[model samples]
Structures are given as C-alpha cells and as structure tokens.
Target chain A: MVHAEASTFAEGLSKKQVYEQVLGQAQALFDGQRNWVCNLANASSLLYHAYHSLPSPSNAVNWAGFYVLDPKNPKQLILGPFHGQVACQTIAIGRGVCGTAVEKKTTQLVEDVERFPGHIACDGASKSEVVVPIFQDGRVVAIIDVDCAELSGFTVEDQVALEHVAELIAKSCDF
Target chain B: MVHAEASTFAEGLSKKQVYEQVLGQAQALFDGQRNWVCNLANASSLLYHAYHSLPSPSNAVNWAGFYVLDPKNPKQLILGPFHGQVACQTIAIGRGVCGTAVEKKTTQLVEDVERFPGHIACDGASKSEVVVPIFQDGRVVAIIDVDCAELSGFTVEDQVALEHVAELIAKSCDF
Candidate 1:
C-alpha cells in the first residue's frame, strides 16, 4: 500500500506526473523490502492505484500484476501476486505476451489483445496489455503485466515508467 | 475478469440500475466457479469494475476484497483475494471492523474509519469501509470488505447490494 502520507496525484494530472508520483511511491513502498512477493504485491498495487486515479483512458485499467519465471521450468512463467480476476495459471516462455517478453528480454506493449496473434486471454475483459520483463543477473526473472479495459489503453509513458518499476523490483528483491 | 461478452452497464444509468446490473454480473461471474479462491477473485473483480464505472462519489472506492476465517485459527480473519494495496494479513475475530462484523454476524458500514474506534489501518488512504459477513453452516466463513478514499463513501444502498453479493458468494463457493 502506498503510505497514506505518500503524495497523491492531483485530479487531472498528466501521465508523466502520475508516473513520477508512482515511481516515488514505488521506491518508498519497495525499498529494503527484499521479499519478491511483497515487492511485486506492493509495486503492482501502486501502479494499479496510481493509474486508476488518472483520467478516463488511463483509469480504465482492469488488471495489474506479475508473472514470475518458474524455477522448475525455466522456460515457463507462473502466476504471481495480482490485483484482478482469476488469471491463466501458466504460460510458456514463447507462448503469450508475457512469455514473449521473457523470450525476447524486452517490453511488450500490445495495443489490442485481440489483434495480437497468439494472445492468451486470461481475463476476457482485458482489451490491451503491457508486459515488461524484470531482469536479474543479466537474465529475465519476472514480468510486470498490466491490462486495461480499453483498446490502446497503455502508452509510451506507461511503458517507460513500468519498466523503471520492474528494474527497481529486480534490484530490490532477493529473487 | 468479467467476460468481454458479458452485458455492460449503459451510460448514465441510475444507482439502482447499476447495482442490479452488478448483481446480475456477480451471479454470472461466480455461477460455475466452485473454487473458493477463484470465486472470490472474480467476485471482487466484478464489484471493482462495476463501481469504477459509476459517477464521482460512487467511483471513490479504492479497495474491494475478502478476509476468510482461517481454519487453523477460527478466531482470526486471514486476507484473501483483494484489489488494492497489500493489506493487513490478519484480524482477530471481535477486534477490528472486519472482526466486529464476524463477531456480530452482521454487515458493517462505516461512514468514516477515523471515527471507528480501534479501526485497523490496513491502508492509510482508506477513509470509509464496509464489511459484510459471509455465513455458511450458521457461522461466518468470510467477510467482503470494501474501502473508499472519501469519507462517508458508502451508502445504505451499497450495503444492501453488497450484502446480496456476500450471500451469493457464501452460497456459491466451496469454502
């Protein structure tokens, strides 16, 4: 939870302003918290709340969470902490957007899940998605996945800010 | 997640209409899902999305989720599926608002958390809260907890509709 004392984005704030506040809250919420689960839990919560407070297009966010690489199967991803509906439990490294992010070691910002070939429909309400791979020791460790209810719900600003959050989580947690 | 094909609330609908729609969605979302975890996951998602579409005061909601009775410790309530920040992991029965609801076996609708004595500060940002006990076999199995960012955020109508939701969840899930 973002501390009650943490700064809040004023109504009608720009995306950059919101992400900036989110980054501050993310650092404050995650710093020194070494448990990956706790870190992801709070980080996802911070993003979910921050964007939900923003304008119409941004506030349509329906899902925000993570998918961590399975230790038993390095090439597969398993469900992690999340803030929305029951999700698909597992995805192969190259099967879905999350897996594709892990396989490519890059961010996947899908403007429309329906248009993205081989898209995995975990929550049927999600229309767009952004998945950012978290890295540790020069390899992908997990991916931060955010889904919005509107098509093209995410933008470049969200991608950049979330990538920063993923980096922070990768470094702070003892994954 | 509410299925993309699920009927949606039309623009500018009345509060009563919205809740009725929400109730219908809740039933449809939970109908065939028997797993307790999966049921709570989708139930909360349904509420979160249903309210997020409402107007200002109604849209002030920040947290929606559950606290189930821990089998090993019937005197405590353990956090279950939730949307919002990381929450308080446990609340002793007869203690906090959640506990008070369990002890009293009634719905709790607090207009302001600040005025509620011994209110547990799970999320400092939460100003108002509502908790409804889910009963099974004549005992409380869980409580549906909703928190809002605005003081006096919940209403009698909300209490009624959410209580209905709790009843549905209690009946549908295999606790």
Candidate 2:
C-alpha cells in the first residue's frame, strides 16, 4: 500500500490491498452498530467503493449486496439492502446462484452465469458472479452476492476475503 | 415480435419494444408516487428488472441508478436510490462520467470507461456507460447512469427511451 490519502485509496492497489482496506472499513462500519439493515447497507457501500477503485480485471466487480433468508419461508431468500439496480425479490433455497450458496453452505465463484443452470439473471450484464453464505447459530441466515461483467472475474482470493467479510457480518450483526 | 407469455417477453423484441416495455413499467411504478427516494428506488428497480430479463448482449446492462444534484452543494452530485452495489456518494460536476453528463447537460455514451479521461470508476466491471441528464426548468436536477460490462453495451434507442423516462420522472415527481 503506497500510502495515498486515507479517505481515497491510492490508485493501483493490489487486490489483496483492496480487500484488506475493505475488511477494515467493514469492521469500522459494523462496529457497535448491530442494526442489520444499516450494517448491510454500509458494508455493501464499503465493498463497492473499495472494489470500484481497483485496477482493471480485479476491479471489475459490478454488483455487491446481501440477500437474507426470509424468516417466513425457510426455503426462500428475499431481497435485502443492496447497492445495485433492483433485483429479484424472492429466490427459493435450491434455486439460482444465491440459493445455491445457501444450499451448499459455501462460497461460489461462478466464472459465467449463463453457463450456470437455473441461474437467475437479476442484471443480465452480469457475466460472472460469486455468492458467500453467512451463518449464525449453525444455520444459514444471509448471503453476500457479487456480480461482474467479465467471465472469470472473481478469483479464489476474492472468495476467501469476501467469506471473511461474511464471517465478520455473521459475528457482528444481530440478524 | 413473437408472442411469448405476457410476463416474459419474446426473445428478439426490437430496441423499440424493450424501451416501450421499460417506459410502461416506469410509468406504473412512478404513478402518483412523488417521493424522490421511493420514486428513484422503484425506477432503478424497474429498469434493472426489465433489462435483466432480456436476451444476451442486450441484457448486458450492469448498473442502473441515479445521482441527484445536491441541494446543499449545487456543484455536486449525490448518490441516490440505486439497484447495484454501493457507490461513490459525492461526485463533483465535470469530474467523472456522471458529473460530466451534468456538466454538459446532455447525454453521454462512452464505449470504454478506462479510456474516458477523469472517469471515476464506481464499478471496475463496468466497461461501457451511458448517462442522461434530467432537467427541470432548463437546469440539470439529476442524471441516470447505466453501465455495462461489455464494450458498447447501450444503444441510441436506450438514450432516447431513458430520456423519455427522465422526462416522465421530472414531470411526475416533486424532486
């Protein structure tokens, strides 16, 4: 991290640097703020601003937001706070990219959404995608979904870092 | 156009058809709802859903949202309701793609964000972008910013149609 301004990151930060900055921001945003909606809103905002500033391919993240499992329907996920265009309102547990993350209880880094069978096209411009499940009390509560325009846009590092963010949210927020 | 289910459009609707459908939905969503935040929120959602369900290539829209002129700071554009990841909250006029649109008070369609000088990267995945200014009494009030992952994602028809939507919004909403 060639230190630039503290508010705006120096251009050309490595992906690792960007993720580190994002994780730190996430911690600061969620600190002592157990309000789920506010935390998710700012977290998504922090991730967007962080990834938006990175260079080329690594910075190609188009969408980042959360989808919480509907308390009314254990088998369904509903739209929560997000930073992108409007998205699908409900997704079944076993359906689409977000649902699959919940069904599998793991991070999914999809290189091509068109190739993902049953993939929900919330933003057709989204070519590749990733979804990380957030768990609390040993059950899935919400998932973070990020989409990109290029195929194979997300790497394993992104999965790991975002999963770490998810873990943070799982521990920090009140659901 | 081939007739498909009413809920789902036929695969190859001309640009005209897509815009018409989008404009209709925009009208329905904004009807009698004058609140700016709610109106912007639903408008972005309507556009995202309309475009996301389209066929490939045309469906490649990545970001759809608004940047309203700040009431306190006349020279700034503040992030408004949107459907994608978090975004840069404040943009100075003439600084970035969104700001440039406001500065010029005209529609801007860029094939590549990387090439656009002083372009602020809100989402690294956005390769192509279009911004349309919303005018009230011959002054810019807000602008609609749409981004795509693919180069040249938007078309002239999108400009015309989205401009129409902006007109409707300017007329319908109390800003």
Candidate 3:
C-alpha cells in the first residue's frame, strides 16, 4: 500500500536541513519504484510542497515539474508531470531554458528569467527559473524545471541540491 | 508559443458555470496538442486550480490527476500527471476506485472513500473521490481521479461535467 505523507519541514530547520530532509524523503519514496511517470509525478509534488512549507522566497516557488524527450520527436520535449498553473506543451530543443538545458546537457540556473535571452514565458508570474538535466546512459532523458516568483529566488546551494536530485532521478527511474 | 494563463474564475460564478468555463479553456488548450502527458498535465492543473479558485467544499479539493494504463503492465494503472501531494505509484485493476473504474469501464462516484470496499488511501485526508474512465476505441485507456477533503464533496453535476471533459480528452489527445 503506497501512501503519501504531507511534506512539512520541521520548525526552525535551515534551508540546507530542509533540502537534506527532502532528499532523504525522496530516496525513501523512490525505493522499488522505477516508473518514470510515477516517480516524476511524485517528485514534482514533493518539491512543490517542500518549497511551500518554508518561508518567504522559497514559498514563492510557482512551479516544479519535468519535461521528457518526446518519444515521437526526439528534438522536442513534451510536458510531463507538474504542479503549477498550466504550462507550455512542447518545447523544441535549444529553444528556452528547458531546451537550453537539453542543448547544453548541463544545469541552467537563471537568477532572473527576463535577463535570459530567448527565455520562454509559460507563466507571466515566473521571475526566476532553474532547469536540471536528468541523464540516463550518457543521454539527456528528461529535465527538472522549477520556477520562482521573485528575482534571484534560487541560490547556488539550490542548484547543487537539485543536481543531486537529478542524479537520484537518473539512477532510480527508468526514463 | 504555448502559454499557461492563471486559472482564476470570475466572482459569483456558479459551480456549473465554473465547469463550463473550465471545459472551454481545456478545449482551447488542447486545440493542437495530441500528447497525452502534456494534455493530462494541463488538465490536472486546470481542474485543481479551478476548484481552488472557488470557495468552500470545491476549494477543499486536494488531488486532481490521471492514472494511465501502464503500457508495461496492462493490468495496472500507473500514476500520471497530477497536482497534489505525493501519491501511490500504481493500483491494480478492480482493487481501488481508480482501478475499479478501469475494470468496470464506467465512472465511480464515491461520496465517502472510507466506506468503499478495498479503498486505497493514497492520501489520508481524502474523504470523497470521483474516478472517470477515459475511453479510446471503446476501451479504457486512462482515468481522471479527483479527491476532496470533505465527504460527498462531488455532486452528480460534477460527474456529468467531468464525463464531458473525458470525452473532450478522448477526442483531442492521442492515448
């Protein structure tokens, strides 16, 4: 019987502590589950709620989700599981932040989305964004995309933490 | 360029009017997209946020998502796009509300989840649930599952409206 617990960070926990807790919970949740759809669906939910459980900027996270390589069209990414307002359905490779992550095969952590050239605005309220590539067998299989409502909303620590999450998803799920 | 507008219902709109508005928006969103993942992802977001935009019992909706028939395992429903806390990864056919909808090829409108035989408590806070089957070629392909925090939170009108939504999805997306 799979059950989902409410993702509430303990009181007075530091940001790093909160991330560590989220990472631990994610590992436990992914145990014995290799389905990409299921894993990504829960992953978005976990990240979205975890951010909201915090104060200020972190709580301003407007989106958390995944975009996977389209099976029919490898040059594009189709939206996967996500928690947010509705979003762009398909993004061609190298087109936007998500596309650039696929093109660069590395994490793109933009402090301000408006400053990024060719940034696709799916939600007008999103001010900053991060996209982490999830690799499988040396090829980018999917990307984790998070958007915040404030400028410079994510830190270097956030990039590092989410990279770890990317690696975890890469290893744990069969994309 | 695909854009996601904020799903804010106008003030004083009746529940039926809300569904009608949602259906119209969904049709417009699905106009050119055939990918099930993208459509379902947006569908869940639309339903979840639309409900939250309202007051009281409708606002109490905690989960709105899809359970797709697992291609790898034809007898089980794997988690798909969703907006909520983390959830169960899979449910066997006929085992739970979602699964039963698949097995029966009909909608399951449970006023109280606690009393449903073999109820799968993915989220303990869920008091009521409605599962509507999405059919393709006269066979069930996926299901729309919505969970509410209050007993009898869904009405017959909701069921009818969602059935129309299901038909729209069936015709619009490629499963």
Query: Which one is best on DockQ?
Result: 3
Looking at model 2, give its docking quality level: incorrect
Q: Sort by TM-score, best first: what order?
A: 3, 1, 2
Better of 2 and 3 by DockQ: 3
Query: For residues A71-165, what per-residue lDDT tens digits would candidate 3 score against the true structure?
Result: 98999999999999888888999998999999999899899999898989988899999999999999999999999999888889889999999
User: Which portions of model 3 show Cα errors greater than 4 Å?
Assistant: none
Candidate 2 scores an iRMS of: 9.0
Candidates in order, interface RMSD in Å: 4.9, 9.0, 1.7
lDDT, candidate 2, B1-175, per-residue tens: 1111212445667767877876776676555446555456557766765677777555788668788887667988766666555555568999988989999889998888899999887667778988999998999999998888799888787888889989988987666
Taking the candidates in order, what DockQ does each have?
0.17, 0.08, 0.75
Q: By lDDT, is 2 or 3 better?
A: 3
TM-score of chain B taken alone, every candidate: 0.93, 0.90, 0.96
True contacts kept of each: 0.18, 0.10, 0.87
lDDT for each residue of candidate 1 in A1-175, tens digit (9 for 90 to 100): 3344353457877888888887877777665446565556566666777778888778999778888886657878866667765566468999878888998899999999998878988768889999999999989988999999999998898889888888888878766
Instruction: Give the 10-residue window scoring lowest on summed lDDT in candidate 2 chain A.
Output: A1-10
Q: What TM-score does each of the candidates earn?
A: 0.66, 0.54, 0.96
Q: Order the candidates by lDDT, highest first — what do you get?
A: 3, 1, 2
Given candidate 2, what's the lDDT at residue A169?
95
Model 2 off-target regions past 4 Å?
A1-7, B1-175
